[model samples]
Target chain A: MTLNRVMTVDDDRFDQLAYRRILKKTNAKIDLLPFQYATEALEYLKSPTRRPVDVILLDINMPRMDGFEFLEAAKTELENQIVIMVTTSMDPQDRSRAETFAPVRGYFSKPLTTDDISVIDRLVAQQ
Target chain B: MIDHDSNSRAHAPRSFAQSYATALATYVRDGNEENLSRAYDCARQALQSSISIGQLGELHFQAAQMLCSGSPSPSPETKRTEEFYLEAISVYDMALRGYGESVAQLTAEVLERKRAEQELRDVTYELARQRDSLDQKVKARTRELQAGLERSERLNSQLQQANQEQAQFTYAISHDLKSPINTIAMLLDIISVDHQEHLDSECLELIDAAQATASRMSRMITGILQYARLVGQEAEFETVSLDKLCRDVRDDLRQEITDGKAEIDISPLPDVRGMPSQLRSLLQNLLSNAIKFRDPGRPCRIAVSAAPKPRNCAAEITVSDTGIGIPEAYRTRIFSLFQRLHTYDEYSGSGIGLTLCQRIAGYHAGDIQVVSNEQGGSSFIVRLWINERERDNDTQSGDDG
Candidate 1:
């Protein structure tokens, strides 16, 4: 797939830093857009003049707005935005729940690794 | 004083009438008290013969006519005869009066008897009605008790569901707590790996310490999640062979066994009915602890054996090891969650292994206890209730293995 801009929504500062570091280490030719809250990410996606991203790396547990709530809002706001759940939660129920949403493409554990990035790249390519 | 002849003539009505005539004629001719007394005797005799009053009257009239037909002064004689007749009939009047009194008494008795019978019937009916009413009351009470039992059963089920939900909530919280620790450890690893050239040796050592602490916290959270998951889940029970299970656990801990050069001796074990995975976890934890707490000077010698306790339909499994024995004070506390007797530097563990073992034993309707061996070691005794049928099957298949 021709890689473009990718977005991340996470509440933890360290996890956000780890994701940036891991993505940078992967040496992927893609722009990174990070948000501290799912609500902010949903707002950005809903913006009229916002540049659309190819994939959204979403976190499940967050303050104020959770991943499921964001997915519910995004179903109507976006047409074909692929969301990949990268979360610290190892709960199978959360993974299954995220997969229930139409836009969700894949689920991964916390501290996104170079291998997980490759998996995401392949998922986006298939989509 | 009637003669025998007059008494015998009384048996015949015609003869009695002639005798009464003769007696009357004598009474009239002689005008004597003796003959008049005789005429009264004739009437008494007639009453004794059970003659009716009308028959006696006819006999008297005949006797009076006979006396009048032959007498010169018939009028006076006939008057006397009629007087005698009235006297004779007085005897019958007295008898009839006695009979009427008895008849009245009998009628009164009959009425009393009928009243008593009616009262008895009423009493019997009332008793029957009371019995039926009591039956209805008993049935209603039984229904009420049944309803109470059903309501209690429903409440008990709801309570069980609430407990399961609470366990699930605990599991969720533990899972959420684990993520941040894992993330922190990952971040520390990144720093230690990427910034090692620019950082001094002390800074790198501090990072290592931080990473170790984060790893320990992560392990603790994972342990809590596992314990909570055991409470929330309902696993199926099957026949589990402890001998095979021990071999599998040994294989799983092969790396640790090789590193410590631990000698594990497993005896033939009995089959029990339990959750296979939980039982495996329980044995694995015990084996892992035995290896982890081995004495530095001596070789680690671990032995596993089982014996049947027929009284309770259970098997007593003993896992004894030549390791650092627990003191008497901490023997009981070792089974409790997060109760550590050693520092992290001495022993690396989440301190939840024994707690998980205890929980798994409880799930199988069993219990586990620790005993300090006299030979400077520790032994864990687990009593697991086994199905009698499974035990029999195990006995039958004992020679096959």
Candidate 2:
């Protein structure tokens, strides 16, 4: 399929549940998937089955491989995709570092809801 | 009782007239002696003038003959003069010694008084120095307090802004989540009513779980909305029927209390002036907290009471619970937004309940605080001010704009 896709990667089961429930409400013309494991999700996206994810929702805290590590590894392979780091932390230094990735589209907080859709949609349009 | 002999030896009285006569006469009598020769020379001319030269010579010879005879008359006239001269000489010697002693004593007294004056002057100077130093310290301390007050004011304004943001977060949650819950609820109701026979048991069970989750989400959203509303609107001050109001609140929360294995005891409630709904929610939040943070050892018992405020001035309402009380360190933090002493799995609600209660109490010109140990249950006290209620409402509402 040529249609663009959006996906989320987080270690938390509750975060995945909340992300799915929220992302399903989007009226955007793109496919979306959520994953709890970074490597498995990365492998699947790298395989021919999933193509051209338009937006990525990456969470910071995970078991072994965190969002920063995932970004480092997948930067070359999926350099084409727009990455967004969503977390509960309001730390300014982290935000600045995330901004170093030129393709980063947005950063948001926890309890993700329909409120976040407009910002993401705007970002997707501009890109 | 001084000894007279000792006193006499120490000093003697002065005789001025006797001392003058003795000095003149001794000069006349001792003209030949070296000690009084100067006086004798000065008197010789006067003596020669008083007697003719031949008579002076004859009187001298006769006086010398009478003085050697020891016959009690140098001539009787010379005898009287010689005896008076002897008495005068003794008086002169006594007067000289007395005058010397008086001069020495007066000099000593003057020096002693001067020394005492100098010591008093030094003590006065020291006291002045101490007073000046104390005055300067007091002024410096006052300035420091004023500066500290300004800094605290800045922090207070920042805290007020944070509180407003927390309230706004609630509004956002409500506005964002309500429609989804309603849609899910409606969809489930439609399916259950229309397609009862067509649906299998497992499918029915899945749909039931979905509906229940949706319901729970709806309740949580409503709770968040109520919390936001309590903080957003200005408080309304009126006569609050404490007894009836609490009863209604208890009735509303009875099911939740029972579900959590709790008992609520309402002591006699005093009629107070406050916003009835917000105050009811405040009491409800406290009681609900008692249920939410229950201990393994204890079935929760919430005790509510009211008594005359100290100094017979205000009214106080107390709510004590036999649940897992707040830790001593969390007493201040529990009033903060999203401050959860316990984890999410242990308690099933948003962490802003007590924060809402605090905001409501603040709006009513009242304050609420908690006192508890590590494992012991907590006692919460609410102090109210009826006269300041309108002013407090104005202040709470003023922050929004």
Candidate 3:
């Protein structure tokens, strides 16, 4: 599938800034949508008037709704979108748990590098 | 009195018969009170001579017949003789009555004694049954206590396992914190490289300071993760040569040693039983600390030596350094986690090295003590067991971490 637009769900503002900067530096032809709360991200995915998101970068730890809770609450809305778990968790258990979700396609540590972006692009090409 | 052997008193019974007849004839002829009393005396004497009741009856019959034969018309005399015989026999009748009362009393005493014996047997049987019941109760209670102890032991083991898992979880969290700090440092680097021409020197210096602080925080987090990992994991033990281990540590810190103009003197040390990787970390931390905290006026000089405590099967290894010494008040506190004596501007460190060293020593069934040397330096004395048996003994005594 061709990459189009991406959404970021993270509680940390600096992490969002880092993502924006890295994505801008890469100059990839993709739209960026960022949400500080997983609840807001889930609502945006459910809205009919909202732009269709091709990829979702979900963080594990957040307020009100965690990444796993979001995956559960927006299961039907996220069927056409690929979810990539991006968080500051290096725990193998988190990776294994993310693998249980059908929408989750990849896992990466925080401050996604240029190399990580290329890997995501290649994952999209594979689909 | 009664005759003990009636058969041996046959001659005495014949004499008694003649005496009794004479007394009866006299009493009948005289009809006096004295003669009548004499007749009673003769019968009493015969009874006292151990004669049987049957022999006395024969003697009376013979006396009665003689009196009747002597008189032709002897009706009155015969009546008097019969009255005297009846009086004599009354004495025997009174004796028989007293003997019957004595026999009845003896029979009652024997029956009472038999009842008392039966009661004693019943009481003894009851006591034996109670004792057996008590023994069984005590045995059952002991078995219950043993089972309770075994259950508590199992719970204790499970609790220990849970605590280890919690420590592992803490380590993972600490490890995750490093990524964000790294990103901050990376972003600072990117800013400095990409936008240096647009920013002032002051802003660049501030960024540099922020980057430095972030790096220090990263190191401290790494130190915490290391300590947590050690707490959660168990290591395999092996025989370690201290002499070679010390040389290896010195080689690992070659750059720092050269920069500080440090000299390390190692003697022939003893072999100790411990985890090799942990021991290496222990020595590395000590040597690194010595180099980092050296006196500005003097070159760093460190000596590593060992002495065997044969009585305890232990080796006392000393690492003495000619560096800035620790104060007496902080000698014990230096081993606490995150306890620092100086700031990052003076000497940069995570402040967890000594704590790790102490933990490693405890893992080997040992302890570490610090003392100030005479030359204004510190000596770290570590006591480690020389063999596995000694270590096991120490561990059983609750000395290990």
Residue A59 accuracy (lDDT) in model 2: 85
Give the clashing pairs for model 1.
Answer: none
- Docking band of candidate 2: incorrect
Residue A48 lDDT (model 2):
75
Report the error of model 1 at residue B113, Å.
3.3
Summarize candidate 1's per-residue lDDT along B1-401 as a digit string, tens digits: 24545666635786777777777877767776777777668878888877788998898877677668767764778777876777678878877888899899999999899999899999999999999999999999999999999999999999999989888998889888988888899999999999899999988987987888798788888888888888787879999998999999999999999998999999989898888888998999999999999999899999999874444446788999999898886787788776666545667787789999998987786778899886689999988874545445655433222
Q: Residue B297 in model 3: shift from native, Å?
A: 5.0
The CA lDDT of each predicted structure is: 0.82, 0.68, 0.82
Candidate order, TM-score descending: 3, 1, 2
lDDT of candidate 2 over B31-148, digit per residue (tens): 4345243323323432323433344334434434444455553355465444434443344345457768888888888888888888888889888988988988998999999989
Give one digit per residue, the lDDT tens place, for model 3 in A1-127: 2556779998666578688878777665668999888889888877878887667899887644679989999999888678999988888999999999999999999889989988887787776
Off by over 4 Å in 2: A1-13, A16-127, B1-177, B188-213, B311-313, B342-344, B373-375, B386-401
State TM-scores per candidate.
0.54, 0.44, 0.57
Q: lDDT per residue, candidate 3, B216-322, as tens digits?
A: 88989988888888888777888988889989999999999899999989888888788778888888998889888899888789988887444444678889998
DockQ of each: 0.01, 0.04, 0.02
Candidate 2 collision pairs: none
Clash totals for all candidate models: 0, 0, 1
For candidate 1, give the lDDT of residue B266: 97
Q: Which residue runs does candidate 3 get wrong by more than 4 Å?
A: A1-127, B1-130, B133-137, B197-206, B308-311, B338-348, B386-401
